[model samples]
Target: MADQDTDPRLRWLKPLVIGLSVVFVALIMALIVGLITGVPQRRAEAAKQTAKPVPANLSPAFAEQVLNLPRNSRVADVFASGERIIVRVRLADGTERLFALHSQTLQPIGQLTIQVEK
Candidate 1:
């Protein structure tokens, strides 16, 4: 009587164990493949994020260009955009000015004066 009851339980236990083993093996394989293939891609993306981008229209002549500023004026900051370079200057009178230049030819494109209204 005991043997008959135990046999039914054992029959389902074998198949359940086999199914769980197969699932575990599949999970381990997937983890291994992901580690091997995904790590390089993640590293490459990180490198790209850290690297500085060079503008497409940048020219060698930009190094030789001279930008004249006003008397008693000092450069505050400089920034390079897609096709333009922006220069921020602080004047002797405490006024701020922005100069935009073409990136390729280093030609003056525009100027903006920042004044506060009293």
Candidate 2:
């Protein structure tokens, strides 16, 4: 009643409503931009944070070559001790060589062989 169009007290209401609508739209746009930019960045940062694991079966060529041993041998059980891998190899001379392999490079740290008197 009393005709809202002619009401002088509500004169400033239209601009206030429009201003609030603009602020709401701006807040929504900011939120959308933050999500679009922040999500992938966080994901990429997380990906870079973790380290990758080495393959369990490394090629034998990476290991050290020894006397009378076959080429391209398979990497058997790798026993890790601090920074070394204890590699077991079957030599052609009918002897077992316990090769100490490096944990990082898979190289032979040392070799141990058992000898028996005939």
TM-score of each: 0.52, 0.36
| Model 1, residue 14: C-alpha shift (Å) | 8.8
- Let me know the TM-score candidate 1 reaches against the reference structure: 0.52
Error of 1 at 48 (Å): 12
* lDDT measured at residue 48 in model 1 versus the true structure, 0 to 100: 95
Model 2: per-residue Cα lDDT over 1-118, one tens digit each? 5456567988788789999999999999999999998999999999888756656665446546443445654444557677677877665555566777666666656788755556
What do the candidate models score in CA lDDT, each in turn? 0.89, 0.70
* Residues 1-118 of candidate 1: C-alpha lDDT, one tens digit per residue: 6556686648788678999999999999999999999999999999999886656665558678888999999999999998789999999988999999987788899999998777
> Which ten-residue region of model 2 has the weakest summed lDDT?
66-75
For candidate 1, list the clashing residue pairs, or say none.
Answer: none
Off by over 4 Å in 2: 1-4, 50-118
Best by TM-score: 1
Q: List where candidate 1 sits over 4 angstroms from the true fold.
A: 1-58
